[model samples]
Target: MERSEPARHRGQTAVAVVLRVLAAAALSVDAVVHARLAPGYQAAAPGGLGEGNLFVAEAVAAALVGLYVLIRGSRPAWVLALLVAGGGLAVLLLYRYIDLPAFGPFPAMYEPVWFFDKTLTAFAQAAVVILAAAALILHRRTRRA
Candidate 1:
């Protein structure tokens, strides 16, 4: 299949791709900040804000995904986005299940607030991932048909 869109739609695709790249970059930055600045941050520890290796992994993955989106178009981008989103969801769930209670003072010590923040961020990431994936899939189908 040609997999091409109308010229008018091309602009929209470009914008979407740029936005996805930027979003990935922003996430990478966030991970870096958490890993480097957050005190007591440990990958293995429950309460740690961020771990060095994990943050590096996420940043690298995100950067590569963003690059692929920009250079190769939507399908690969969608797959990478899904992986990134799933990772976020996994992190949130892990925090909820094991980290929240095991390493925390519960609702005290600002743990509850942090938990809510992370949860919301994860949800937002998942939403973006779903939207991008859907857009790519729909575009592909339309092009094929």
Candidate 2:
């Protein structure tokens, strides 16, 4: 059975919209978690560029990217969202398992424990990564076709 062009287009649009909403929501969660924990982290690990400040920065970036994706589910938006989520997730996991020393202006953020906020942020970041990757793929295919 062959689907009509309009039907196919509608289906694609629906998928894109759903992906955009999910990705944006996940990013929002990540932003909120980081912002909420920034103050405590800053007090715990103060440095030239305190970990709390870093968390705040991440929260801002996540919020911006999430907004962009919500407004425009374009390829570029997906790329930015992917970068933010992937970078945050990588840093979180690295710090969770490894105790790396701070270089330059960064603080030593090494925590080998999984708490509520940390776990929530991790899950949200991971969700954004997956959703953004899928959106990118969908956009790429749509463009090619």
Candidate 3:
């Protein structure tokens, strides 16, 4: 059975909306984790660009990308959201396992603490990536059709 043009469009829109909302929620959760973990980074990084500033930067990036996705829904927005979430997740895993080596002006950031909030953030970031990727695919499909 073939869906009517209008029906198909409506279904696509609904899917896009649900995916967007989920992406935003996941990004928000990651942001909250960053905010909470900012203080702890001090213990790990200590006297470097570690504690307050870096975490705030991460949180701000997540929130801004999430908001941008909500408002714009453009390809670039999805790309940026992907970079933010994917890159952050990569960093989290790196720092979690290997002791961060001081590179350039940055100090070593070896934070192996995997508490509830941290775990939540990791899960949320992963979700953000998945949702953003799906939304991007939907956007491209809709555009082509």
Off by over 4 Å in 3: 43-47
Q: Which lDDT tens digits does candidate 1 get at residues 1-145? A: 5535586477666666665665565445435443453344443445544354455556566566656655665666767766775675676556555544334422212233355446545655566566566657666764774
lDDT scores of the candidates, listed in order: 0.56, 0.92, 0.85
User: What does candidate 3's lDDT look like per residue over 28-145, in tens digits?
Assistant: 8888889877886667656667656677888999999999888777789889989999998998888889996888766676778897887888899899899888988999899999
In Å, residue 132's CA in model 1 sits off its true spot by 2.9
TM-score for candidate 2: 0.96
Best by TM-score: 2
Task: Select the stronger candidate by TM-score from 1 and 2.
Answer: 2
Which of the two, 1 or 3, has more TM-score?
Answer: 3
Model 1 residue runs over 4 Å out of place are 1-40, 43-50, 99-120
Alpha carbon deviation, residue 33, candidate 2 (Å): 0.6
What is the TM-score of each predicted model, taking all chains together? 0.56, 0.96, 0.91
Tens digit of lDDT per residue, candidate 2, span 40-126? 888865655799999999999999999999999888999999999999999999999999998887878889999898999999999
